[model samples]
Target: MESKDLVSDDGRITYRSGVAARLAGLSPETLRVWERRYNLSNVERSARGQRLYSAEQVRRLSLLKQLVDQGHAIGVLAPMSVDRLQELAGAAAGRPKAAGPLKVGVVGANLARRIAASNRDGSDLVVQHSWSHLDQVALTSPLADVEVLVIELSELHDSALPLILSAARACDGAAVVVLYRFCASATIRALRAHACLAARVPADVGELLSLCRSALAGDRLPPAPPLPTSDLRFDEDALFNIMASGSGLACECPKHLADLLLMVGSFERYSAQCASRNEDDAQLHNELGRAAGQARVILEAAMERLARADGLPLPPGLIK
Candidate 1:
């Protein structure tokens, strides 16, 4: 196999087995063996059963050879899906586009600026304007064009949720991530019942940025409804009626409490798995206990800070 054997055709290419072997920096026999053993090559065959190589295939083979030269195991890469292989190659070539943070028309300037500032290094779109500006953005922007919406409903005259819902209707598939300061569970539940998407963002810019990033990345758990409206105290009858209605008690107030419930649900899953598995029962129990305890500590610390920032006393019953 030699370099001179390589021939090009109008940006297309045809490879003699020997030439492909040379381009791949492998012996012709080794090339055939790779084709048979790993199915790694994307070579096509002419009607005469002669193998033909496209330029793309040649480039891929060259990349594969480079990876092998770098001590990567060919066997490990042999079964990679084409998409995964391309992603790896793109990453190696630094081709992945790093679009700045997805934009949002944040309703509250102070909170919006703080959240945007926190996510300076990550991707985000920050809108600093009045609620009316938010409405205009949502109504006129291309549908589902934005990934998340951060609105401060507490300061608004009209119900923010309706605007959000209208935006959600316009956007259709886009996620409407609402930001709330202090809202009752009933309000949150009402929003969720209408199938609006929302998440609880801490007052801290850092935490809010993290929340927004996770939401935009589709990596966070599906959020619960907004926090319970603070001013409204529901009577038992009212609570019971809400509970017996559609969505059941699980969707009831303190909308973001769903995050807690979901976290516990995960713990329950691991607990069940440990109980079902026969090996290392004691070790598993200890490991789970430690993880849960650590999580509890972190949650408590954050809750204390959040309580202070919001100027709200932590409900005694809410502390776990």
Candidate 2:
């Protein structure tokens, strides 16, 4: 069903599967599985046979996801009513219905202001610290006592990875939410691998708040898949030869090729450090592997192009 179907003249609001998934912090596939296996919610079918969910159902699903993240078994929570589920969650947390506000540390002033404004009507969230840059969070660990850390960035750059990692460490077990104006797929994947939640900018404040709640409740998604490395074996002599040939190429090819090579080399060094530190499971390591894999592809293509330009014989393995 299209998103337009979310509103009706009867004053009831419904959401399609995609919208529901976003609200509930679940994938559409996971929602379908829940519907088929656990009968978690009463989903309706659109005229085109697409799934539709009511507002209450979405809330239940969000609560379920949060509970599951808190280590509650889905089989137990799925069969219970929303009130019962809330009671159980509150009991598990050893808190009253109206618990104290969550302490939050925000990295950007604008984000801090927006969060403050959003909570003007009252919410169980408090902004304890605000910094104009991530560097401050990394250095001062101002968020060390907060329950959650929210960082706002214009873009996700390689240089920012260390700062993010350091902030995560300082915050102890606090959940992290990274809101970016623009981010690459690799960067998103990397952040997820490190247990950091990422969201795009221009998002609804409600959704962001929901994300924060879920994160604080321990509802983190699985790590991204490891980078493909089956064909990434690096041959020292072949790479040296390619660089030598690329250096003599006309135009920008030489510079681009050199940059790619340097990037790959840097990634390799970073990966080695991660392994030495026993941080092979860390997000930065996986990101470095993915970056190195990408660089290898470009470097190989450049080598092939240089070989064609020089009329040199191509290596059998590099034919593709």
Candidate 3:
């Protein structure tokens, strides 16, 4: 019944379906489809019949998603082992040989200068031009000439979603990369929904270069599908029975929930700062962000279930 059984000998972490989905840049329903249709991995089920995945399994799923994005069929890739999948990914990535420095356009002058300076060797990628605003990119012509368009934003806002989408469309096939200081799960979801790529602020220039190369090579993952509505049926009688039995007091569910919330919130802020200050730590920070986001989702769902069972309305902004 222990979820730790899903972990591997190397101490790789285990994740339930929701966390696995987020880690693999997929939806839970899509994971189910891949498992049911192609038997993608030897997924383990928890005592409660929930799906669990290991870190290695998530990595394989990510590779499969990347390969499928690059025009490889899922049926062909699904049966392949993780090593084979990685080989294919490497091969696809290797196909893009830079005849000249890959042309990159940036929406922020400072980011553009940083990337340009980072590419002093002039080998892999180059920042060709930079605009102070997204509107300037629209005013300019010959958008197709740019291989990649990089947009740096201070924060992920609801208003910026359309601008990012429009910028991507304007380029007419140029890969879009969004760099932001702070991002929410909803914002990441929105960016992916529009087929644009995103990375946390202070992202490594090398990684950004690699992403651009992949994008130019036609490596594009499909947008994740919307999550299915929960059909959970709250058991009010059982909850009351538990309370009547005095077990609820011993459990201290409220105190435990508050502690969890505080820990997650604190980690989230710390991760954001780490992401902003250290380029090398950006990936880890982003992972932490996703984990915190998933935790929040689960906690919110639990709160909603509790409210429903108690016949009480949840606090404003709690569910959203």
Which candidate achieves the best lDDT against the true structure? Answer: 2
What candidate 3 gets wrong by more than 4 Å, as runs, is 1-100, 220-320
User: How would you encode candidate 1's per-residue C-alpha lDDT over 136-186 as one tens digit per residue?
Assistant: 656564544455555544322224567767766655445455665334455
- In terms of TM-score, the best-performing candidate is 3
Which lDDT values do the candidates have, in the order given?
Answer: 0.51, 0.68, 0.65
The C-alpha RMSD in Å for every predicted model, in order, reads: 16.9, 14.6, 19.9
Model 2: worst 10 consecutive residues (lDDT sum)? 217-226
Please rank every candidate by TM-score, starting with the best: 3, 2, 1
How would you encode candidate 3's per-residue C-alpha lDDT over 221-298 as one tens digit per residue? 111222222322222222222222322344556434533553454455556555666687677776776666567667
Candidate 2, residues 1-320, lDDT tens digits: the string is: 44444664577888888889889999989888888889987788767787788889898998898777754557657899999987766764663222357778888746666666567665656888888888888677444678888887744555587898898777776788887654556677678667677776534456777667756655541133556556653353454344444444456564355445644654554554453455446666667667767777777667677766765445558666
Off by over 4 Å in 2: 1-100, 221-320
Write down the TM-score for model 3: 0.43
Residue 307 shift from truth in candidate 2, angstroms: 58
